[model samples]
Target: MTDYFWDFDGTLYDTYRGMVKSFVIACTESGFKVESDQVYKSMRRTSLHQTFAIFLKNVDFKKKQRIVTRYETVEKSEQTNDRPFKGAAEVCKWVIEQNGRNFLVTHRNKSALNMLKRDQFTSLFTGCVTSENNFPRKPNPASLNFLCDQYQVDKDNSFMVGDRALDIEAAHKAGIKGILFDPDDIIFVETVPDKRIKSLLKIIV
Candidate 1:
């Protein structure tokens, strides 16, 4: 059986609305003046650094910090509205039924655990590696490597499933397969994945 590592936001959970709203609010409050569509597009298509670089161009460090702080406040206030996509919980449960392990590797903090528990998905994961764990961010593979080591997972029998290129790159860096969940086909990448699934249900053993 394979062990699956899933991304939280935009993969299993539909957090774009809350996240994009937070970005827009932060940018506006911090005097960044970014279009909401641009914020949404950049966030969905690129890394957070790239997103900020594009929208908050030539801005000072303090302004960036202000945007981050505002974004956090907005995100926390809207956290409860971030729900999982259809079939997310069911697919996780199915993995367990098939004797496969389900784990989470997300940039989110411990609050992700609260959302999972609220959705009755906390018990489905073997473990979760979040931002609070202090591992290097994705495309580096350190966190993924840590999770694999903790679970004694066989790299060949494991997959990283996410909605971003960093996710696939991290999997490749860790010598594991990757599955890109591109329901909207918004991601255009040169690195092909072992699997490209449009729905969580497509991730079958």
Candidate 2:
């Protein structure tokens, strides 16, 4: 069976909206006004640690902590808006029909994961990997390898669907196919059996 590893925040669901509110709350609490789209991109695609580090460097640690705390709370409250993309639910069902396992990967904390569970997507996902789950953040192979082991999926047959470069990096390191999804970079590179996609609807049969 094939294993489908998915990113939750920006890929499977439209979480940028919620993240905007959370980022603003966090940055504002830290006395810094951040650009919403930039912060969302950093959090979802590249390095969240780097983004936070930049913000923290400009402010006192106590205030930074308060900002982080506020973000955690704000994000949890904003979970209601994190709805799945159109036809994504059907895609999940289609993958299952093809004898595939669906894994939800995220850097979100436990509270955020719990919010998804309460929001009705829990049944759609067979397993979830979160920051609270103790795996190193994305661009790291540790978490994806864990999912492979749990689902008994071979790396070569597995595919990760995410809206970030880290997803491709992690998939490549783990010997799985990294199918990147980014509107700006639709140019699919043939090396390592990885390809970049412009839209979820374009995912081929």
By lDDT, the best candidate is: 1
RMSD of 2: 2.8
Candidate 1 on 114-185: residue-level lDDT in tens?
Answer: 999998898999988998998888888999999888889999998999999889989999999999998888
Q: Once model 2 is optimally superposed onto the true structure by TM-score, how far is the C-alpha of residue 36 displaced, in angstroms?
A: 2.1
Off by over 4 Å in 1: none
Q: Which stretches of candidate 2 lie over 4 Å from their true place?
A: 184-193
Kindly list the per-residue Cα lDDT of model 2 for residues 45-76, writing each as its tens digit.
45556678765686778877788788778977
Provide the lDDT at 21 for model 2: 78
lDDT against the true structure, each candidate? 0.87, 0.74
Query: What's the lDDT for candidate 2?
Result: 0.74
What's the CA RMSD of model 1 in angstroms?
Answer: 1.4
